[model samples]
Target: MSSNSPADPPVRRIDRVLAFMALGIAVLSVLCFFAIMISTAAGMQHADYATGVWPIVAVLPLVGLPIAFLLIVALLIMSIVRRGKAGRS
Candidate 1:
């Protein structure tokens, strides 16, 4: 009967799933970022590159994944929070 509870009707079970998925994406994104960092460091230490472009290309995932992940998480959280608030109202 409360406005904040699931019985509010607007905050569907699907919405909760989506929010958790967003959380998962955020976590996975952070993990991948660390993996890329480690790979980059290993590559640098081993000097196993023939072309100099390997380093540049290898570094792209580090930057791109985190940025995209952050955006996705931000949008997802904002959306879920917005929906939750609207449900309350």
Candidate 2:
């Protein structure tokens, strides 16, 4: 039911690239967040809050990584919906 043939449209390529980029960012942020959490925990075990751990714990949790994950999910969902619509037409 679609006009597009075996080859994907150029727009699809751009979308794929963006999706991959988002995924990469999300993965990296998640890894970094876990590392920070572990470090924060270990730092707290010694009751030493002066090692700049609080800032990473406070700021990173409130921003950055969550935004990256949300962006990645949004991009992937959008891509899926668009691809479905394109295929149906």
Candidate 3:
């Protein structure tokens, strides 16, 4: 027997593509954050700075990560809402 339940709507190709993109972004961000944290920790332990560049370089990721996170979240939300609308149609 076959059913036509809303939960059983056929999956769209776009949704799968978007999901993979989001997953990639999440994985990249996690790695980026980990590297930043490790470098920051190392910089703190060995205070052998002459030009004060390490501190500024370390802060760059901390500042940019939040913005990237917000964008990724927005992308996921948009994809979900679009899929919901398509299902209703």
User: Which one is best on TM-score?
Assistant: 2
Rank ordering of all candidates by lDDT, starting from the highest: 2, 3, 1
* lDDT winner between candidates 1 and 2: 2
For 1-89, candidate 1 gives per-residue lDDT tens digits of: 56678634355565576556656655665665666577776665545544665554556555656665666676667666877776788
Candidate 2 TM-score over all chains jointly: 0.48
Preferred candidate (TM-score higher): 1 or 3: 3
Query: Each model's TM-score?
Result: 0.41, 0.48, 0.47
Model 3 clash pairs are: none
Q: Which candidate has the top score in lDDT?
A: 2
Provide the overall lDDT of each model, using Cα atoms, as 2-decimal numbers: 0.61, 0.65, 0.63
lDDT of 2 at 41: 71
Query: What lDDT tens digits, residue by residue, belong to model 3 across residues 5-45?
Result: 65555656865765566566556656666765787676745
Candidate 1 minimal-lDDT segment of 10 residues:
49-58
| Candidate 1 off by > 4 Å | 1-11, 44-89
Q: What ranges in model 2 sit over 4 Å off?
A: 1-13, 40-54
